[model samples]
Target chain A: MTLPPLLEQSVAFLLPYDFSPTVLLVCAGAALLYHRGWRRTRGGWGQALLFWLGLLGMYVVLQTQFDYYAQHSFFMHRLQHLVLHHVAPFLIAVSAPAAILGAGLPDRIHRHVVAPLRRNRLLGHLYAAIQEPLVAGAIFVGLIYFWLIPSVHFYAMLSVPLYNTMNWGMAIEGLLFWWMIFNLRAPGASDMRHYGYRLLVLFLVMFPQIALGAYIALSNHDLFGIYAACGRILPITPLIDQAIGGLLTWVPAAMMSVVGGLVLVYRWKRQSQQVEQPLSPTLGCAR
Target chain B: MPRFKRYLILCLLPLLLGCSEEPPGGWYGHDITGVMPDLEFNLVDHRGKAVTAEDYRGKIKLMFFGYTSCQHVCPVALSKLAAATRELGDQADQVEILFVAVDPKRDKKVLDEYVTNFTPDLVGLTGTQEQLKAVAKRYRVAFSYEKPRDNGFYIVNHSGAVFAFGPQGKTRLLIDDQSKTANITADLRRLIEQSSI
Candidate 1:
């Protein structure tokens, strides 16, 4: 009685789509506006869009794997995890100034939501809390090794609830991981070089996965029965899927390194402009 | 103007003189109070011994907050603490190291074993969720659990400073995560000697 047929249909339609990307954009825009308008709108949005485009590309990669092979092929399953968990989220975090949210949002929403957050003491504390390096770093490394070990990953793969939980867990980990690395908030502050170094550290974090993936690809051991089943169904050989899995680990991770570097450059230039701004004539005359 | 300048220089004299320190080292350059906040708590140790902040009195306690399930930083910090203790040799006796598990639910007994695997001297501590919150609040330590989507496995967020407590059982210093073992050893030695005096 609570659910009519049309009501059920409407609820089903509303369930799948996520508004997270738009929410993030609005938040970024608000932060940018609070800092004042970008020196150039198109340029700032373009850079942000470029980063968003890269994120979209990675998301597509994830969607393809999730749709086609998550349950069907072990190799595709792992690749999907890698893309969603590590690759796409990092691209999104480093892609903006806080201004994206401000620029994109309507005035009424800005007054109601954005204005309040800018003044919020709890939000400030929350920001400070997450920026704690030890907390953020541990979460990142913990999720990786915890999920990577054969015992855990194998069990998660076998169980439906665990598989879904872990898949999203990695993405959340990815968000927290890059938030510490990309966010300008304090409690833990690292310069551009440190950010660059941390990316290398993250790359090393995934090294074990690459090695394991490569080992699985090269060896005849079919840990999962599905990989064997899919090998028979596919046009290409199983070797190709295995190779793709290993290569995907290192190759896509390079995107994170490049993203880190670009964020460093962007932040540094923004800082320099603020620091080296020419003094007003009125102020100079007073001096 | 000369009198004003004299007073100005007089006020600034402490800033200059305060920069000076004793022979090998001094912890005066940084504002220790800003880096470390006063914290007090009652908890239990790995051995199930009832413990409180008072137990660490008279010794300079080096405290690191983390969970046993942590794969990298926790072990790295404990190893560094061990290495620092080794580096101190005799002086290590004066410094007490404590690791408080942020995820007390799973980490209570689990961390106890994990930490012992690294160093017997390192004490692993935990309490009920409410108690952990009280301790974390007092210490200005931040932590959160990201809800697990499918399985019950989620990450615990926590602060990662190696806090140094004075002999009087008050937080007196904080060593940033990047602080090296050699620097930690030197700092601990100085804190131990200073507190004794």
Candidate 2:
């Protein structure tokens, strides 16, 4: 069976460099749920496109040959985290797929599994605690710092379990943080009703990220030795690699906060508009 | 304390636990005990004999990845390992340096000579692409070849780490470029002493 060279190359690129069943299962499960739910709810075309793109983006970075470069290059690793922790999660959260996913769930399963789980006091309290704006903001930034500590980063890069944990943590935390920012529920019904508080968290988190990114980018020495320890895939100098990685951590990442703040402003405006138009039946029934 | 505060501390307990600085055994090298898997490989030795990690069982092994043609890092790292083993005196025999050649194609002819230049304790190992990939992935290390130059010479980049394993093949320490020969020797002595007991 001889395949065309281009097709073969594409296949190789799509194949996972280091396969993980967890990545496969989670991605496939999400896609399946979204597809089923989309048919039932007939969600907006734009939202569906965003959800699919976000899911595919996360899978591509985690499961494809891209992961091999991420393992070997400092810059590539930073890019992967940026996608996992910011861009892809941002798209997924902004799409607001929760209602559709819930609709996609089998009724019996939702009744017996999800409904009861949601009603669990401990789980509810835990969710509320994590959803607290200050707590969520702290964890969001804290994870980035914790994983970047040179010694911790060394082990995280070298150990497969730790590496998986780091990536998963970033993806999960990004989802939670971005979901808090983008959730469409009315201010009175939501955990953090004041958009002002979220705006503050976003603004506060950006400075620390900028400082950390700037520190790494401007540093003369190689802060992360793991890349050198494990040979880099690219032929670039260590300093160049570190610089590029630091810039990724610094620039686009902080820019995401600004973008998120803008989204918050828009939502805040829309909420006020809805409140003023309460007499309209459409506006009253929207929630 | 408030209930929410107590819950917040509970949620954060694991992160705090993970942040603890010191590795338990306190080896000079980065302690990787139980972090990486045991040594296991199928490769050909410098003398062209097919061997497995089992062939070197009961002896402490310090595995490193490099090609024979590596001009600087490989040579310097190999020499450092040689010197570290030499400083171990009579216990030198207990430590074997497995120099796994990532560029098997270019290294095949000169591999034996390359290892012998450093010390008798060094063993040059090369393997099939599948075999090499397995070993490299097992250690979370990587190697890649640069584009061939006009002269047909190309450079291969590889891990500069030296992974130390105990007699039973359990991974213990990772020695990087910054680790001095004395520190490596001290760790090797500790590794040997622990195995003997």
Best by lDDT: 2
Clashing pairs in 2: none
Stretches off by above 4 angstroms in model 1 are A1-45, A58-66, A105-130, A133-138, A158-161, A187-220, A225-240, A262-287, B1-197
Among the numbered candidates, top DockQ falls to 2
Q: What DockQ does each prediction reach against the true complex? A: 0.01, 0.64
Off by over 4 Å in 2: A184-193, A279-287, B1-25
Worst 10 residues of 1 chain A by lDDT: A278-287
* Candidate closest to the true structure, highest TM-score: 2
Residue-level error in angstroms, candidate 2, position A36: 0.8
TM-score for candidate 2, residues paired by index = 0.92
* Chain B TM-score of candidate number 2: 0.86
lDDT for residue A101 in candidate 2, whole number 0-100: 86
